[model samples]
Target: MQLDPALPALNQTVLISGPGPFVLLGVPGLVALHAWLSVPVFLLYMAALAGNALLLGRAAADKALRAPMYQLLGLLVATDLVLATSTVPKALAVLWSLSGEISFEACLAQLFVAHVAFIAESSALLAMAVDHYVAILPASALQGTPDRYSVVGIVAVAAVTHGACVMATPVALLQRLPYCGQQALPHTYCEHMGVARLACGDMRPNIWYGLATTLLSPVLT
Candidate 1:
């Protein structure tokens, strides 16, 4: 493809593209069925949200469920709520209205929240496992069991670590690359590497970082 001679910057070999909106193509090969698909997807989203909300409410109301294990379950429920809320509204909009344009900033925010919530949920599950292990052990080994403060601290650390991974190198690399005007995303959500792949420049760093985080988050928890 020849560059437009009228624009000198366009002729440059390295052109840094500015941040722009992206078009999310929800569920490729299913465009023809969006009308039928959206109804069920929306219903599932609502049901999941309601179920999680009820869990949180019960945890908050009952004094007997205030144990650390129950607290971790509550955290998991909350994380699920956040994860769904982060992506479903935008996805449903794309499905129902056929409008999938998301601003670069909004897309990044969505990616961050979705990833952090997933990581947090995993961490909660790990914490629950540890709690169960401590409970099952004879009283002698239980002395070393972590307290509620420690559990809360661990969850906080997981959130911070995952948040840092998403906000640090991948996003910076995304902003530095040039895009060849390819903004269509293949999936319903704006995953970091998914958007990064649309860039015209080298995306290896973003890809590697994304893979590293995907493997490390669960292990670290």
Candidate 2:
């Protein structure tokens, strides 16, 4: 494919074979504001990281917090850390230095990690709610309370199976489509739909699957 001369010099490179690097146009029309935006965003990232880290450390140190509920909290904290780490640094890079070039593989990996962390986080929250409900039930009504290890194991497995495995389908489908023309993605991160929209061929499968997953995610959770 020939590169479009009308395109900006930055975007003249054609993706002839593989899925090439994408230029992330962070928060479109906010180039001037990126410097201002980065301050609060940086602070928020720091706060989230510090708060979660403190909770994780306290849970590890305190024997009383070794309960199943605290175990779920630990899982939540860890998921949050992964979620933040996956996207925030890249965003900061975009805002601070306009460094938004991301290789195809890296983009897919980012989306995968972000989605897995999200699903895992949701599962942990749901498990915590169930744990609380079970706690309030009469002893006679309960068959057997699940221990902390069991709860953790269940959450981990669900995350790996549902989050990691199920999420791979979209990545694989997206990978099959050819990406050509403009490579500028108008977002801070490589979202499923955002990336799919850039493909050259028919994207019905990608669209329908993404919608199906979005709708079914809550029900599955």
Candidate 3:
């Protein structure tokens, strides 16, 4: 079969190649009603943002909230903020503009922020568990538990651990794989598995690493 002269060559690199813009279709089997669905989604985002902001402000302003447990709550609030912001605004844009296209760099940034925030939240919950233990137990065994240093250390470790496992390695692997297939992401956010699935090459490493880091966070914490 002869190809049309006006059409670009099959092997031609037309710039919209690997790691190209991706479409974030919000929710499964709900794309046809994106406009109507966006209303509630936007409202929920506002409520969550307001609630977390208030919690963070109260924790920062009140002297009583200077305790380690409250500080941990503040950490959780920050993580929630990141998690919500990483997707909600872009999702709103996708709904309103009717265009879900996102640049490769922006998608990568969103993917990193969302995963880190989620993992951090899980780690924060684990830290809160330890704090609860210390609070309930007699003070004689551990007189100065749930101190500022310990909270800071836990947050730092979670950030580093998830950053290395999720953000650094898997993303690097995904980047190396050629994304010559479909670019439309099924969910409302740029996630590791969603993006990795679009790659044309071996995706086992990405999948395994994503599962490992996701499962290991709670286990280790």
Candidate 4:
């Protein structure tokens, strides 16, 4: 079948590919992620899955952590658990050379959770940074601030960070995405940025934000 003339111009780039295997973070090239790497990845993933599940369950059951920090931690852990579940099997399959065909819906779900966790992790780190800053201001600054004010700031930062990422991810995921081929992730984990790069449209903003958020996380702290 004849392809669109412009199709030939498409390179394996975010802008060119528009959304899947070719878009966003554009699957980290063809470099094998350690030959036969499945066993250890499976073990590690299982351990994390178990641990996060317990932590999430306990957090949900606890009444005391209704406080902001614990609340943030609980929610973040829950998201992380979801992310872990979404990614580990895929990675394991790729390593083991098993079934690698992921459906569009499943890919989207993994993409959403994993990317959400990426942002959440950054925001949590930022909150921690803010807390540290507030807790250790110069003595002169401390004099004016109330004794309990630092804790309030910490809570506020945590809540803000948590809410921001939760809100941001869905907008990016559900909104306007360029179509590509059937979804089959190259890596064991579902990478949103990687998938986005496969879109046949402008992806500069996504790339820029990904870089900006990652770079800013440490500095903000």
lDDT of 2 by residue, 60-123 (tens): 9999999888988888899999999999999999988758999999999999999989988888
Please list the Cα RMSD from the true structure of every candidate, rounded to 1 decimal place.
3.6, 3.2, 3.6, 6.7
How does each model score on lDDT? Answer: 0.79, 0.86, 0.78, 0.58
Total backbone clashes of model 2?
Answer: 0
> Which residue window of length 10 is worst by lDDT in model 1?
10-19
* Predicted structure with the largest lDDT when compared to the true one: 2
Clashing residue pairs, candidate 1?
A: none
After superposing candidate 3 on the true structure, give the runs of residues whose Cα lies further than 4 Å from its correct spot: 1-16, 143-150, 153-157, 160-164
Query: Which of the two candidates, 2 or 4, achieves a greater TM-score against the reference?
Result: 2
Q: lDDT of model 1 at residue 33? A: 85
Worst ten-residue run, lDDT, model 2? 9-18
User: Could you give candidate 4's per-residue lDDT for residues 1-221 as a string of tens digits?
Assistant: 34555754443222333333321111356335444465577788888888887877777788875554565566567656766776776666666556566655566767666665655665655555655676567777767655543564565456456545653754465337676453444455655565665555576777776677667755754
Q: By TM-score, rank the candidates, best first.
A: 2, 1, 3, 4
Best-fitting candidate, measured by TM-score? 2
Better of 2 and 3 by TM-score: 2
> How close to the true structure is residue 99 of candidate 1, measured as C-alpha lDDT?
79
TM-score, every prediction? 0.85, 0.90, 0.84, 0.56
Q: How does model 1 fare in lDDT?
A: 0.79
Q: Candidate 3 lDDT, tens digit per residue, 121-214?
A: 8778777887787778766887665665566667757664865465778678878888763778887878888888877789998888878876
Error of 3 at 205 (Å): 1.4
